[model samples]
Target: MILSGMATPTRRSVLALGLLGCALPGQAEEPIRILTEEYPPFNYTDKGKITGLGTEVVQAVLKEINLDAPFQSLPWARAYETAQSTENVLLYSLNRSKEREKLFKWVGQITPTDFYLFSLKSRNLHINSLEDAKSQNLQIGTVNQDIGEQFLASQGFAVGRNLQSSAKYELNYEKLKLGRVDLWVMNELGAYYMSRQAGDDPAVVLQKALRIPELSGGGNHMAFGLKTSDAVVERFRKGLETIKKNGVYDALQRKWL
Candidate 1:
C-alpha cells in the first residue's frame, strides 16, 4: 500500500543517503543530474563548490524522496538539452512555457519569481507601463537563450546585445550598473539576490515589475524537469507533495534567501 502524507526529508537526510549509497552493494544509486546556469543566490560556483538556493531546494527534494543526487553548473542551453534527452536528468528554475509542456515531467513550484524592469536609481526613468519602455531608448539585459530573451525578441523590443549565460547573475547586474545596458530584466527574486551581491548602492532600483497577463498567473511557475518516465515522475511528484506539507521548503527558503 502507498504511504499517505509522508513528510519530506531534510538536508540531513541527503547527507545520510549519500553516505548510505556508498556503503551498500548490489543497490545501485542513481544521482539526479541537474542543469543550471549561474543565477546567484540560486546557483553559483564558489570555492570549487556549487551552492545556492536552487541547489539547496533540489537537494531537499531529493532527500525527501530518499534519492542520492548532485547538481552541476552547466551552460543553460546544454542543460536544457540534457534534461530533455537523458534519464534522471533535471533542470531547475525553468520558466514553464507551453512550448515545453510536453518535453519533460516537473517537480517543485519552488519560488514565486516576479520579473521586473530595473535601472540606476539616479536615472530619472518613469515607467507607468511596458509601452512606456518603447518610447525611451531602453536596452534590457537578459541572459542568452533565456525566456526573457525570447520574450523580448518576440516583442521586437530590440533590447541590447545578449549577455553571457553564466551561472552567476551578478555579471549582468554589474553590466547594468556600468551603463553598458540601459535596463535589466529578470525575475524578482533573482534581481533581489543580484542586487545584494552588488551591494546596497543607491544607484540601483527596480522601476517597474511588468507582468505578462498571458503567462500562467502573469508569472512563471518554476519546476524541476525530468525525463518522461512514469515511475520517476510519480516518485518525484509524491516526494514534492510531502515536502510542501512538511515545511521543508519554507525552512530552506529562509536559510538561503
Candidate 2:
C-alpha cells in the first residue's frame, strides 16, 4: 500500500525504478526440468545411466540452445502429468497427436516410428481393426496414460474391461508372452527393441497384428509445458532445427536407431 500522502506511481516512474524488469522482489525464473520415460532407443535407463536416441537428440538441441538441463527418466504416466502441469518442464519423444496438440508448446520432431498392435505368433491373433480386437474380448496391454492407451480410451475402451494398464512396458511384454495379454500396442521399432532387450527375437516371436495410421508417422517431438514462455519455446524450437540441419540429427539416428 502507498503511504497516506504518497501519489500513485506513473508508468514512466515504474520503469525508471526498474520495477518493470523485475515484477516482484524474489520472483525468479523456475529451474528447467527435462523429463522422459523408458520407451527405449528414444529414451531409457541403461546400466545406471540415462541415454538413448531421443535423449541424445534432445541433448544436441539443448547444446544449440546453450541450455544445461539434464534429462530424468520417470514412469510414463507421471512424466506426462508433470509435463502438462508444471512450468519450465520439457518432455521429449512425445507423440504430437491431435488430442495433445494444444496441451504444450511443441519444439520439433525427433524420429519417425510405425505404431502397431503386436501379438505373439503363437496366439495368431486375427486383429485387423480396433473393433475387431475389441470384439474378440482380447485383453490389450498398455502403459498407463501412454499415447496408445489414451487413444484406445478415446475410442471407448475402458480399464478392467478390455484395456489392461501397466506402469512399465516390460510388464506388458512379459504378459503378452505368457498369454496374459492378447495384444500389445506399441511402436514397431520399440516393440522389437524391447524384445531384443528381453533376449527374445522379436521378428520370430512378435507379429504386427494391426497398424494404427493415426498414431504412426510424423515422428515424435520435444515439447514445453503451457506455463513456459513462448520465447523459451521458440529458442528450443530453433535449437532442434539447428541440429537437424547440421548433420547431428542423422548421426544420432545412425547411433541409436
Candidate 3:
C-alpha cells in the first residue's frame, strides 16, 4: 500500500523473511554490534545499564525482527568513527545530513529532535536570533554533537572549549555558574535527559535555535547507521516501516517520553 506515495510495512506482510537475513544459511543468530554515544534521554547509562528512549526503541525494534544486537556506549566522536571504520556495526540517533547520507546504511528513525540554544536564565540575554549572540562570548557545550558542531564551525563561532562525552551537560551547567561560558547548544530532549542524569538544575535553558540550511530543509531526523550496503539498508528500512505502521513507534514514544 501507499502512504503519501511511500511504501508502508505491516507485521503480517514481512515479504519473505528468507531474503531478510533471517533464514540465510550462512548467517548466525548472533547479536549485531551497535556503537552509541550518551545523548541523554536518547542514549545514556543508568546504574551500569544502558537505557534511554533511543536505546530502548532500537532494542525493541531489533527484538521484534529477531535481530540480536548489543549496544556499546562510547564518546560520540569515537562511536561515530567506529561505526564508519568497523564492520557489521551501527550507530543510532544520528542526524541526517547530505554530507553523511552516503556514509552509512541508514535505518529506523528513533525520533524527530529539535535543536536549540541554551543559556542561563539569569544571564538576562535575549537571543531573538542567531546573530544576536554573535557579539557575546558564547561557549556552546556539545560532545561531538554532529549538527551542533558542524553548525558552529561553519558559522565561525568560537567553540569555547571541548567538553568530555559524559561531562558536556553538567560541565556547561557549572560553566554558567562560574561565568565561564555564555551559552550552550543542545537538543531540547537531550538537555532534559542530561539534566535529570546529572541531578542538577539547568541554570541555562534553551534560548533559541541555530537556523542552518541543512537542518531547516530536512528538519531533524534521528536514525540508525550501518555500513553502506543495499541489503542491510533495505532490511532496516522495512523493519522501521513495520514498526511505524503497527503503532509500535508511537506507543514507544508515549511510553518513554
**What is the per-residue lDDT of model 2 for residues 135-248, given as tens digits with 9 covering 90 to 100?**
888899999998999999998888789999999888899999999989999988889998998999998999989999989987888898898888878878898888889999
TM-score versus the correct structure, for each prediction: 0.75, 0.88, 0.76
Q: Please identify model 3 stretches exceeding 4 Å from their true place.
A: 1-31, 158-167, 197-227
Whole-model lDDT, model 1:
0.65
Candidate no. 1 TM-score: 0.75
Name the candidate that leads on lDDT: 2
> Model 3: number of clashes?
1
Clash number for each model: 8, 0, 1
In Å, residue 161's CA in model 2 sits off its true spot by 0.7
When superposed on Cα atoms, how far off is each prediction in RMSD? 10.9, 4.9, 11.8
Q: What is the lDDT of residue 173 in candidate 3?
A: 51
Regions of model 1 farther than 4 Å from truth: 1-31, 135-137, 158-168, 202-206, 209-227
- Positional deviation of residue 230's Cα in model 3 after best superposition, in angstroms: 1.7
Q: How high is the lDDT of residue 107 in model 2?
A: 90
Residues 81-139 of candidate 1: C-alpha lDDT, one tens digit per residue:
77787877777767776666776676646655566667777665667765666666566
Given candidate 2, what's the lDDT at residue 83? Answer: 91
Q: All models: lDDT? A: 0.65, 0.86, 0.64
Q: Could you tell me how far off, in angstroms, the CA of residue 87 lies in candidate 1 after the best superposition?
A: 2.7
